[model samples]
Target: MWTIGLGFVAVLVIYFTYWLNKWSNPRCNGVLPPGSMGLPLIGETLQLIVPSYSLDLHPFIKKRAQRYGPIFRTSVAGRPIVISVDPEFNHYIVKQEGKLVELWYMDSFSSLFSMEGESRTTALGVIHKYVRSIILDHFGTEPLKEKLLPQIEVFVSKTLETWSTQSSVEVKHAASIMVFDFSTKSIMFSYDAEKSPMKLSEKLINVAGGFMSFPLNIPGFAYHKSLKDQKEALTMLRKIVKEKMNSPGKHEDMLDQAINNMNKEKFLSEDFLIRWVFGISFATFEAISTALSLALKLIADNPAVLQELTAERKAILKARKNRNSILTWEEYKSMTFTLQVINEVFRIANVSPGLLPKALKDVKFKGYTIPSGWTIMIANSVLQLNSNTYKDPLAFNPWRWKDLDPSVLSKNFMPFGGGIRQCAGAEYTKTFMAIFVHVLVTKYRWTRLKGGNIARSPLLGFTDGLHIRITKKSS
Candidate 1:
């Protein structure tokens, strides 16, 4: 009887070993990257949830990449996630011929965007194609140079007028309003700043950002509040769309164009349009505001850089005969140092710290097998600050752009992400950030307020509000 019992125990041990091996191995044929995933079922969820995770992930991913090579798997939310940091791997993932992977986690964004049914899956793709085409047609560089610059100048002037009177101001809040107004007017061709439909739209964005972490709606929870907020936001958007549809004026703005010129095959419903517009607005606001705050903080800390940029701006303005007008896109693009500064800011700020991609099939890499149904995260924080890609990765050196080949920079840069799902607002965002930085540096001189540390905000932007004392620069 004792011999039989020992043999059974040995059999059980063998079965458990087989199961563990299956669980730990990557399914795909390629090399799997290396990383330690904490205890069972929980994975890295706790580490990711902590506010300091952004800062922590950089070092952790870098160490893993050094040990594991480009692609690796670790557990997240009770599932295995393959993280890819190699430029070649990233290119393969992003630039694949067709839909590489379905963005399942983006389902969370569906609730935020108020997309339902099939619309949720396809809304982002439709909006991307539509907005890119329309924006290029209407608000392209030439038009922005000729028409939008004047509009921006007027808007900036109005903003300065109001801000000049305030003793102390929250820069992020103020910048948020400014970007919101600019984006709304630019997209809708409306200048009714106070009564603009974008006010509630902005609130919807806030709700979306805050709602993601809350438990699923079981009634009377934070998720419920987000659902309610989302409904209110959609109602406002619908009202605006209905008003635009009824008005018979030649459709000049994006809203009108979307409603009038939609491709039946890919055309979005009116409700989809409303939610997309809001989504786009929020994305624009978040990217631009965070970029602006970072720029401000950088300028405040590096007086010499600020002086150089200011001098460059002065020289450019002087060469243009002191026009005292907003810089056109052409003019903005010519500000090479400004571009470098913004790029550096993005590198350090590292917004959109990671990309979540769901696996469609079992894929193997680096001796590990990542099974299907597992969600993969490409941690940008790891790649952006990797010493192999960036020298003095922590320092804010705008001139680093000058040192590297443009091709290398493009390949290594994960700021806007890569692949088919790259940020749709990349060009618009760059333009907005350039305009914002130019205006702030040229119009005002600011110093960081004593006892203020500009830390990462809990909301994925700068946390400290970037308090600075501003004194108008003498013309």
Candidate 2:
């Protein structure tokens, strides 16, 4: 009887080993990146999803990259995810010919943007290409030179006029409002300071960071509140779009341009128009606001750098001989210090830590296999902070760009991202930053508050609402 029991146990152990070997081995083209899926169903979810898990994923990813080399598989939210750090592999995933990547946490945006129409899943590649072209054409460098900069100056003048009456103010919230106004004016062409229902939109974006990690959207939960806010924001956006469409000439904004230029065969549906407006508007608002806040905070912390930038702007303005004149693309490009400042801000602040790229088929690298249907995150945070790429990565040094070769700088710097789906608003963003910085530094003198540590919260924008006392600088 004992021998019989031992024999049964031996057979069971052999079967288990065989099953484990089959499950662990790379299959389906056998070229997938190497890494473990761990246990079934709940792989790596615990490690990646903890609430206090650092948003700066460098330490974790760097260790993994060192351990597994370049490509490695792990689980995130019960889904197998591959992480690639090799620049070549990254280029392939981001730019080279391959399958289109899906936004894994798309529900987060759907909740925030209230995207509740036909799934974009089926037509993602087509939609991505079309939207990219539209944004690049309208919000590109030339368009900003002709249209956006003038609008930005007007907004800044108006915002400063209102702030001049107040003794002391929070620049972060004000910056957010500035970005919101800019986005609305640039995209929708009309905005009422008191009438626009943007609080819901703000709330939805705030909570969007929390979705996909928690199953809290089941009513009475924080995620549920986020969903509600998202719906409300969407309703507001829809109303605004419909009104603008029906009213015709109430305002001449991006919406007007889009309506005029939209291909009937491509963006035919009003629903698509609404989504485009909302998506672009939200992304622009968040990125610009955060960037501006970081720039301001850095300026306050490093007054010497700020003075240097101001001097350069003064030189540029002197050469142009018109403070009131709008800057052309050529003129804007001439201010290299302004570009350096913006680049430095992006490096230190590092907003939108990374991007998730999905696998189309099993791909191999460094003897590892990343199976298809898995998600991978190219961690920009790690790349930006990598010691090998940038000297003193944490230092807010704008002069770092002065001596660097342009070609080398381009490879190392990826604030807006890289590849085919890189930021459509890259040029517009740089131009906006230049104008904003030029205006603010030339006009205002700001002092950091006592005991304030600008480095404590570096996620871009005023997570704490930058409260600075400002005085008009004497001419």
Candidate 3:
């Protein structure tokens, strides 16, 4: 009996070893990039989500890039992924979106944003374009030149004024309130903070914490909690949709615009609308808010940078017709240094992980063959934080952007992502951040009271919370 048991244990060990390496995608025919596939099922996912408290690239990708060169392969939760930090290869992957790759996200992201079966297949092409077109119609340049510009200015001005009245404010929560309050007016037609819609926006924040985590539905996992929170959010959004469907005219907000287009676009289902709004809500609030948090901390920590930024902002105000006049589109366009400051903030904030695409066909890059159906992770943080690309990449130096070639900068800097599927709200975000810096530097000053420690679970967030006391700048 003892001999039999020993033989069985040996067989089990052999099988485990075989199974562990089996998911490594041997079909790549030894051309897979150098890296470990990690353990079975979970793979290198846990390592990917390991928290790093800094403004640079997360250690997971940084260490892997150092170990295995710019491009490497690893399994993320049993899903084989090719993570390309090579800027050249990243540029290639992004431009080849429709041809070599297609947009994709891990299950964590897919469950929240992806449409199902026919809807997804249909949405990826024309439906996606339609959505972008609608967004552009409302948020595009023409609108900015006319109305949205002044609207955003007033909203931000009042919001910051309110913040000044508070004893102290948490930057993250404060930003959430401001972004949502404005976003609702444009996107949701109207917003009441006490209403379920605004409250639901908060739920999306927790959901994003699990975005890069390993997908596991088990109760304690962040991914599971994310799904739970997402479901609740969708439920609330669903109720809002139903209410709007029954009682609404063609409302003037983005949500109503999409809803009204339902008959013309067959793929625009109730479910799809809920997911889209959920996605937009998540996008509109989280990215800008986290950026504000980081930007404020960076400014507070660097007085010299703040002084220069303040001078730049004052110049914009100086050019205005009068002190009481609002910002003009032309004035906003002239904020050269302010734009640089915003660029540096995004470079360090690194809110986006990168573009996620799936290999449409086996494609070769730098002598390695990426197997068809594999996930491609173009890590923007890796490129943005490269020592060769920027001097002292870890420091918050806005001055670094001054001398760079626009063409070269375009290649390296991709805070809004790239290619055909680049975020439609790029200008909106840039404009928002630009105006935010303008207001913060020119109209008000803030001091960090407590808790501004930075950290990232591959998802950028503050440790305790960035609390600040805001005061109006004395004339």
lDDT of each: 0.66, 0.66, 0.81
Kindly list the per-residue Cα lDDT of model 2 for residues 288-396, writing each as its tens digit. Answer: 7667777877777787987788888788778876776866667777888888889888876667656776665565655556666667777666666766877877788
Q: Give the TM-score of candidate 3.
A: 0.91
User: Per-candidate RMSD vs. true structure?
Assistant: 5.7, 5.7, 3.1
Judging by TM-score against the true structure, name the best candidate. Answer: 3
RMSD of 1: 5.7
Scanning candidate 2 in windows of ten residues, the lowest lDDT window is 450-459
**Please, what are the lDDT tens digits per residue for candidate 1 over residues 1-475?**
9999999999999998776666565454654556655555666655544354343344445556778776766775566777777666666656531244556434433344443465433665654565567766555666566677667667766776677677766676677778777877766764366866456645755564553343445666656777777777778778878888777356677787777764442445665677667776676677677677767876778877888898878877887855675565567778999889888888887776567776556545435555666676666766677788889787888988888777777767778877666675676677777776677777886776743344432235544556666778777
Candidates in order, TM-scores: namely: 0.79, 0.79, 0.91
Which prediction has the highest lDDT against the true structure?
A: 3
List ranges where model 3 is wrong by over 4 Å.
1-7, 24-26, 105-123, 213-221
Candidate 3: tens digits of C-alpha lDDT, residues 208-325: 7678777989999988999999998888888878877776677488888877888777667787777778878888888999898998898888989888887887777676678768
Model 3 has how many clashing residue pairs? 0
True lDDT of residue 69, candidate 3: 94
Steric collisions counted per model: 20, 10, 0
Off by over 4 Å in 2: 1-58, 97-125, 164-168, 190-193, 197-215, 218-222, 244-251, 257-263, 320-330, 450-465
